[model samples]
Target: MTDQSTVHSVTYDLLRTLKLTTVFGNPGSTEQTFLQDFPEDFSYVLALQEASVIAMADAFAQVTGRPALVNVHSSAGMGNAVGNLVAASHANTPLIVTSGQQHRELVIGEPYLGNREATTLPKPWVKWSYEPARAEDVPEAFMRAYAEALQPPAGPVYLSIPMDDWNRPLSGFDRVRTVSHRVAPDPQRLRGFADRISASRRPALVFGPEVDRSGGWDAAIALAEKLSARVYGAPLPDRAAFPEDHRLFGGPLGMSVKTISDRLAGHDLVVVIGAEVFRYYPYVPGDYLPDGTALLQITGDPAAAAAARVGDSLLGDPGLAIELLLDLVAEGSTRTAPEPMARPRELPQTPNSPLTPPEVYAALSRVRPADAVIVNESTSTMAQQLEWLPTTRTGSFFATASGGIGWGTPAAVGVALGDRDRGVVRPVVGLIGDGSFQYSVQAIWTAAQHDLPIVYVVMRNHEYSILKSFAVLEQTPGVPGLDLPGLDIASVARGFGCRAVEVKSGEDLEREFTAALSAGTTTVIVVPTQPQKAML
Candidate 1:
């Protein structure tokens, strides 16, 4: 028989075969068995909470555009990670999450950290969930998890690894290689789409994050050129996928339904690529587009295309569809590039008091590296910031598509990691609100520990300013429990080994932001503003 001591050694070998070198987790008692015989090539990323672990993995997958590995303890740990897992499911981030399970013998009876349905607990949030039927099947279970996590509309997958499995013999098992299938568009469908666009005098292309994720930028641009179409990024893409510098590229449409309609008016045909038809917030109601407008959507996600508020849905691989469509359309016969939308005028800044959000945004805009990634969660400063620092590219910016707070800070960490490997290590600037920052503030430690260069710009307004705005707009008698008081953001960041500064005015912002970026490591700049001004 193979020696028991070599079981974990073999398990580590299997992990290496899968190329899962990084493991994100918060250790617990039940996980110690799997941690045995740890290999030097495998790195453990310590997160203070399960949420941070899953979130970091989510961002890592997004930036790297591949499946990422994550680990958690028992049921309780899995529960803590559920929220972010849901976000991953929504964003289609492929992740493999393994949680330690009680030993097989103790699972049916009393034991510490035991939960009967540990694997099924996150069923709805994960695309696949399983517990190995036998000790030797654990490694194969991981292979299944990795494959499922990489499927289109990829999402988090869960595996419950029993304690005994870590030390079990696996002499007969073969490590399975995971393969991805390529999806191509139907030639006839592509030709029909091209014919429709070629026949339309005023056509536009609308896009979402999938364009970037699916490597469809060239195809999307080619289709746009074929149709002489104006291309606009989706209402609020979580990240840029299309190049914003292209003349045919228009700006992002915000969450306002009326605003989207106003902007898309006068177009006879709208071709949406790799995006949901529309995503709206705050209950705005109106026709999704102006009267007499027609919408066509091409996406890898069938559900997104089908669920669009208004559109003719074409479900397929966005890149392939665009490539085929480009072949069917004629070369020339182009229209004048539509005039670039006028930039929003910045709100006036008052110098006598705290720095206005717009002033802070303007200063950041000036100092920001042109190619840097901007991860925004500045809820209160959204309007002013958008006006001041308009995203010019499809994939150069990112925000919370799940409408969840706390994603921006850690997501920036993931973005930096993703960029690091591609030799495109642009600086990551996180525009986060103080209230939002608290959601997963522990992520700062990950950034600092990895020596990731990120500038976390905390818009400190001392309140859940978005909620306050809603309360006032509704004319509520009093807004209750909305204040986020007594939070010292700068100190919190510094405690995580990051360079920290507080900026209360434009001058302070200019000096501090410049210094933070130049410091060349994780830094937090707390920009304090009046509550009302922060909301503007």
Candidate 2:
């Protein structure tokens, strides 16, 4: 006979059926009831803080190519996780975030841990948010959250669960019925796109992260080769979509439209795939395209295409659209190949006191694992790092596109969790700055708690280097609050239960990086950096 006290047993059974074995969270008193009767098969990851929890889940979702399950405490926890959720929304990572609330009955009278509008708190960040009406509906709410999170324009979803729901008896619970969506371009539309590409003399492909997420890399490559076209990655791509070493691959285009237009001036046809129309920094308005140039865009997002200034937009699944376009273009094609662009020029190494940032990146490139995942947050070293560590594979690199600091270190921990294999666990390295590291140093505790192996290479420049550089460029003297003085990052990492080291020279950097990679634990290596007058 089934015992009446085993109400949560069905909930656990449903969780298992949905294959949500890993739960990421930072627990609190309110969450204890929901965490009760935890199954042996399900593993709970304890994040040091709410931001790290959300960032880790975002990375996990990106790497696994599926929606990740996340949990957090009440109001405070949700507040902490907001920043990371915004970043995830911008990157289009599918995540399901759950938060514990006070009992439903107490919500009316301002209970100890009550959140009146818990679902509305994360507005504009989450694609959908809800609080189930009954305890029996909790599992079904999760189903809806998962589906909404994974739909087109994938992003994080939120669900608030009251503490009493877990303890309540279940009645008339039903299985969640899964829904599938098919979004493919019409055959006639694909043919029109192919005709445009085939008719053009000089065509180029601009690929983006959506292509990588949709598993359209091979199809993109085929399309590029079929047209013998040069391919450029979109400005500030959050993830890699094509191999950088391929002959057809041109380097990343800068964010400015002026810069992009200058680079694309020679080409007559520009085919943008799975990428934004154009993302810019500050105002530097100019012509949307070069003289007489035409644009064609194929994307999974209809809104993105509709918003583009100049383009023949085809809204559909990237893989299917590219495949059909290739089939259509197979009949007639011209072999007009443009002169190959020169390889990225290597930055000259300098022997300056308090090491240059590029030299540090060069040293990192030498010692880092060939297949390691890089999480970059060194704002001053943005141009230099990209030049030095050009990734050849998709999903091997990560960065915060929202320009928010403190994401690199925690995101690295999350990436390691999502991809753990035998022999040498894939090295997750953070190239972060001193000022940025201070913002999220607490994440080191999460790494230690989970025994997650990661190497944080802090560029210790001793100031808000980027801001200082900007001040210098403007010729402003005596800028207050730009200096970050006397903070020992290595000691802080060690205090948080991570191995730590400080590198004063190039020799020290090379030796310590090798040791950290093989140590098989979280390690922080601080490389003393110098302030550069110009952005590298």
Candidate 3:
């Protein structure tokens, strides 16, 4: 049969046309047909586990701003892939996740590898999920998945193809199409919103990851400066949208409703752009807004806009909306600019004493490359990381939007791969907590195999410190399984074929970290940090 006559050939052509030439996967017996005679131009990134497979694809897509292709085994692999799938969804990373299924003919008989309920497996996490009803429809299904995945509020999508369908004959292929990824805001509505900003005596601007993702960083800065407004990074943002070192930057918004509301108490107007009206965890119940404060939000996510507890939300592209707001709002305001947030106190290195989280971050920050990309999962010390290692550029920072732990390790691998792919190879540093590192530690092997330059700094506090903080907050004392006694993180990294070491002093860390940054191979630096009380 001619190249275009078979389902496999046409599908490969479609993927090539869409520039999804790299595939992340963990192979299984059911996927063999699809792998038969894999094209020379395509690269397959193999991760030891499906969770790692999904996370790597997630960060790769995030950094490259393209829909990444992922292939996993049947039902079992899909189940293994769910945690990172949820993270990818919340982060709005566009991933086209596919799985091999039992042969179409064998599926009816309930074969061992069949994913009978494939469409429902990745539910709520995926934007769309489907199993091709016929062999000829596989390519078309993929095309639809691409569109769904790249659309505004972009997220992961899934498709299931029977193992035997790859070679099925097809008469022709469908014409490829382009989909617009941005949705413009309503001009009149934006104008009305701009009027409110102009009228307010005190205004506050809250920026979120979407601002950075949509290239609105400069616009956000302009808007804040125009109004002499305080700029707060959205709480728990997956990406840094504003330069943290800017004088106007007011630090991150609080994670709780009361905290956020209280922080903005004196502001007459609060404009949250490119994020949810709010994302709250550990429920600290209070008024959604402080007295005499008016809140408004601009976001591309309809669901985020709709789900907001209190706020008038404008649905559209946050970047586009902010650009429009800049023109409509007054050129300048007479109101006094709000004071910048207080900087964290500098903690100097103490010899022989266990290193504090701040000291570790301070050491790394001192030598951090200007273009470095940080994949942070050091949960207990996140505030400290933010304080010490500021993100001043777009796409310089990444964390799980879903508050999930495991995504960081594999995601660092993906970020390095993305940077390499785009020819702007930034140093990738993964600041992962010991508890978090264990979740998908296997992913580092992929980096070793690919010879990517990535430095993984494991903050070994030897416990789930964040959970313990929650226990304190909830008044639930004596929580079992809160502490992790013995985990030799360096040994674990060695097993994964990475150059590994354990360092306890700041001096040692700075030396090893600087060396690892230029190591030209994946390196894991495990630091035994003194445990500190966690803060929300």
Candidate 4:
């Protein structure tokens, strides 16, 4: 041992040195020792359930651009968190997911609560997963997990430390080094791709969340301007990569294969930047490509680049790749500017009308602080939200990249925690659906406990409208759980120690929403609206 230190002492030193001072978790008996005499500098964001805890960590990691630490119970806790764990992995969020294992002696006998194969629990999702063979190996495993999580195409990584390991004395790690987290592109290949974009008569750019994650937003816009290309945000983007209000913005692509192909058919060369080659849902059988369109996708994820359905791929940093392309593309007389795309309407106020998603978003647009961080999971109203909200601010929009339903509310709490910790005092707002709200309703308690200033606007449609749409579209008959009845969301929020209110009409919306914002210390305003959807 280099310094002859205890395991807990060494681990604490590493965390403080690395500036990883925040943790999020739901504690259990096995984790009690790890939490003993917990350091005061390290803020622990607590949640009632494992799912909320991981999601809260996921959002914090995304915001801080660093790996956030999360600890869970044994296999049961991991099982509870698997959904959000998969979602975080899909978003490539850098989260160090650690779990407390049963005592080493008991583990051999497959005790009642032992995670028999602990490492396999988060497999295929975590970048690396391990349960150290020896107590001394625990510290080394943690260091490796942190480094691997911060590496490019970053995602969650797992470490299962035996409950007794935290107290073991005389610890030493095999190595301690700085982690480099970038993969620069090959020069020759990048140049050839740039040449294609420069030569194409008609080009389009598909911007995705990685553009934001990789700090490529400026580069994405610069490249589009240089080539005079029409820009479309990749389908169902959890991150708003481009300014929706910009003239260059062509709006988001769709979830169906044929729809995406149809949107890009007019352009000869399509460049998908910093996102998956394409992410489509709802089994609509059709060709992925148009008759003649060619695709070039630039992504940081090796898996995304390798598994692209049809497009050619460039593996590198999204910001770096775009910056290089901007430098390589030459502007000429033939570099004709494309026509500006359709802009979202700033609809005039319709007095005494039924409260709809579009109207609610429009109202929010008028009142919300310009720099507010938007965490949304209003799935059915997502299309309307995208149309109405202009995510011009960088890293302002976030969604469930993995299409998980219950992340929005807890994610909002996590975002507030990050904003507060970073000294970024932007109002954190979450737009969530009633059905999605019920999934993690307990999050309000966490928010209240921390005194986080988060304004939650629940779109109370009293039904799983998105599921209803999908059911009708796919010809699924007699779905029993689609309707959500007798859910008093505001009352429940109040029960969780939140300031809550309900809005029954447009007048109520404007008045109560404004009041919620003013009184916000984790406030919830439930606005019951018609189940009738204007658009799918």
TM-score of each: 0.92, 0.92, 0.98, 0.96
Give candidate 3 regions above 4 Å deviation: 1-4, 348-352
lDDT per residue, candidate 2, 1-536, as tens digits? 14674336666676677666789898987788878867799989887888888888888778777778888988989999898888898788888888889988888898887876898999988989999998878877887887898888788899999888887777634666665533788778888888888887888889888888787888888888888888998877777787776888877776666778887888888988888887665335677889989998888877788788787888887877887888787432466664565665455565666778877877877887888888888877777776677777667878875667777778887788888622335788888899989878898888877777788999888889888776765578898999889999999999999999998877789899889888878989998888755331
Q: Which one wins on lDDT?
A: 3
lDDT of each: 0.78, 0.80, 0.90, 0.85
Per-residue lDDT over 141-254 for candidate 1, one digit per residue giving the tens place of the 0 to 100 score: 777888888877677899888877777765644666867734666667767877877778788888778777777777777777766678886866676666665767776665
Question: How much is the lDDT of residue 243 in candidate 1?
Answer: 69
Q: Count the backbone clashes (under 3 Å) in each candidate.
A: 6, 0, 0, 0
**Which scores greater on TM-score, model 1 or model 4?**
4
What is the RMSD of candidate 2?
2.7
Cα RMSD to native, each candidate? 2.7, 2.7, 1.3, 2.2
For candidate 1, the lDDT comes to 0.78
Assess the local accuracy of residue 134 in candidate 4 as a C-alpha lDDT between 0 and 100: 80
TM-score preference between candidates 3 and 4, better one: 3
The lDDT-based order of candidates, best leading, equals: 3, 4, 2, 1
Which segments of model 1 are wrong by more than 4 Å? 1-7, 256-259, 331-336, 347-352, 392-395, 421-424, 472-479, 531-536
lDDT of 3 by residue, 1-536 (tens): 45446888888889999999999999999898888889899999999999999999999998888999999999999999999999999988999999999988788899888897889999999999999888989999999999999999999999989999999987767678999999999888888999999998888899998999898988988888988899998988899999998999998888888888888889888999989878898789888899999998999999999999987989899899988988899855578877777895677645536788988888898889898889999888988888989999889999998888899999999999998889887899999999999999999999999998999999888889999899988899998998988798899899989999988888899999999988889999999988867767
Better of 2 and 3 by lDDT: 3
* Candidate 4 regions with alpha-carbon error over 4 angstroms: 1-4, 171-174, 332-336, 344-354, 532-536
For candidate 3, what is the lDDT?
0.90
Q: On residues 99-159, what C-alpha lDDT tens digit does candidate 4 reach at each position?
A: 8899988998998778879988888889999998888777777788889999988999998
